[model samples]
Target: MTRCRLCGSTALESVVDLGATPPCESFLAAERLDAPEPTYPLHLRVCTDCWLAQIPPLITPEETFSEYAYFSSYSSSWVEHARVFVEDAAARLGLGEDSFVVEVASNDGYLLRHVVDRGVRCLGVEPSVNVGAAAREAGVPTLTAFLSPETGAAVRAEHGPADLVVANNVYAHIPDVIGFTKGLRALVADDGWVSVEVQHLLTLIEENQYDTIYHEHFQYYTVASAIRALASGGLTLVDVELLPTHGGSLRLWARPEEAAGEPGRRVADVLAREKAAGLQELSGYTEFSARVAKVRRDLLRFLVDAAEEGRTVVGYGAPGKGNTLLNHCGIRPDLLPYTVDRNPYKHGRYTPGTRIPVLPPERIAADRPDYVLVLPWNLRAELVEQLAYVHEWGGRLVFPIPELSIVEVER
Candidate 1:
């Protein structure tokens, strides 16, 4: 039995089983094709004690993102989101040139660059070699090493404490989940803020976003689970926000007890809403799994039928979520001929495990495929506008998950 990583509770039950899938970032080299791919079980289980949902131990952070391939600057939406976050964070916290800021797992300095733009004293601690290097190139001072209790001590030893510590979408990646948050508490100043963004478990289940169930994303979080973990580490939740990025996400802010900062009514309200939505209960999980399975079944049927009708199909956005959706749905060259990515680094490479080729966006514009699959369904509206020319050819875009639907040309 795989015990819960956060709470160490052995009384756990399977919530969703996505069978086996290749690591979302395992985009293989051409020569490596035909070699057996490592397929690991992608099952999410919730601990009876803490109600934390997590995948069983399979992939390590050392293997997942030690040398990362995905760069945060590559996504326009993400970069814009970072800019908005920087502004809002500064406004809310009264941050300015005098305040010191730090970010953990700060990929490519997306948010830190914005901090620097505001003339604040900021540094980024990024463990990934490629991502950290890019941040340095952009004049964002960064330390390249995995964050641990020791690393946190080292950071405190060098720079003392920070006024603001930002950790975006990284709250779920660490398996030593409790240890990681404890490290955060040690690094932030007594009255400083630590803000963390994680995809919300409530949104994932409600939206049937099973594609978010990759090995790298070990734990799915709710406000209740987050509070339980943070309070154990001596930090208190101060505020929370629900974001639309990454299908759905929650931004949580924390500080020490000596600061005497209590969680806001919004945080409690959301937690109460979570319980009211049945997330604290068991039936919500089982029913969510069933709904996610139906999405898979329906997606496969639609793809197979589209093939029979001889309709051309391609994909948009070579995102990690897209890889999860494609790999879980067992889609390959037969159904999706190729996927167009804005990131040139990913354009020529094959998607992990599925081996569907990634090409530039110009390919879609030139080929005018009959049907384009918007894999990053959350950004479907943005993609539709960018590729509106397809409508000129009477082409439509297909969204697989949530439901199998199509968008036709307005004119």
Candidate 2:
């Protein structure tokens, strides 16, 4: 980029190439029956100063989320994750009915419901109309617009500055990284801090999570890089926490410049770790593309080999992450005949780039394919339990990421 999205630093290094892939959420609709599928270069970069992992801009927030498709409630594990976060945050923030809370990119009110249940005043800033409506139905005060400096001012004038701001996994979703952080500064109270959770860039490299590189996840954040980004908006890093969830993420707390309280030791420790890991230098990113390519070769080899033998393989979960995986690996109906999902919105629709038919998950038992691929491997436990019936027919579940494995069920 011209300057680092996180720090405005001009020094950046090109890292892994996810190759060209379609936008993860561009699921084929009836209107696209005869239309051509579009794919853009899916690549990631690392900041020499901030160590933030990021992708070159191919789309905008308005274009990416105007008709959003992902819904949080569809993932049982994520819902439980949200519940736990709600409980812990309530205790930590000591929030009560009068304290206002806001969550940007509040998909379907999965997290805000707990705040509402606690009788706390809360609002959800969601750009997608469909998801915004879902939050409204769930009793959250929903602001159906993209959060910007102007929008944040309007929201503050009406709803007042938030006592707490929670942005889960959405910190990387904004194209205007600087603008969004500035808006965050405007929306939060003078002393109130904003906690943002983003997938750790180091983990993405170590675990070979190239599939996370989709159109929406515009700017990835590392603590070193995030500090610079936050500072651009008159905010300072207050504390940082390492979260095991989402394959290792960082929960960073930040407040305006004049806010009191020293930066936590975690911030310094993580920064040191990144430096030791060479995140402050450009060479750290150069080797990632080879690792990603290896993953692609291995996964494609396994799937295509199974297909050639006439051993049918079906997939589970229509997550955006899965879409990126499918597209980057060039997986289509040949290697994987079809996939299934729990979300009614995605059911009966095809996965965006792969064109893999998305049926109701119940179809798995109906067809009893030789191998059931778990697309969203994060929910392996629930998926295996729900599909335990496969054991009766000598069927097995296959998970290809982090490492390829077969979940064999006893007869």
Q: What's each prediction's clash count?
A: 0, 1
Q: Which digits, one per residue and each the tens of the lDDT, describe model 2 over residues 1-411?
A: 677766677877788777788888877865675788888888777767667777878888888787788888877778888888878887888888789999999989998988888899998999999988988988888888988888888889999999888888888998787788888888999988798888887677677777777888987667788888788778899899887766678998898889847898889999887777766777666777888788788888888898789888899888888998898888988898889888888766788777888888789888889999888876777788887888988889988777778889663
Query: What lDDT does each candidate get?
Result: 0.86, 0.83
lDDT of 1 by residue, 1-411 (tens): 468787778979898887788888878777878889898988888887899999876888989888777898877788899999999989989998789898999989988999998999998999898889999999899998777878887898898889888989898998888888888887899989899999999989888888888898989999999998888677889899999988889999888867946678899899998999888888778787778778888888888898999888888878888888888888989999899888777767899879999999889878888988888888766677787888888889888767778888553
- Which prediction has the highest lDDT against the true structure? 1
For model 2 the TM-score comes to 0.95
TM-score of each: 0.97, 0.95
Q: What is the lDDT of residue 82 in candidate 2?
A: 83
- Residue 229 lDDT in model 2? 76
Clashing residue pairs in candidate 1 are none
Looking at model 2, residue 406 earns an lDDT score of: 86
Candidate 2 Cα misplacement greater than 4 A, ranges = 7-10
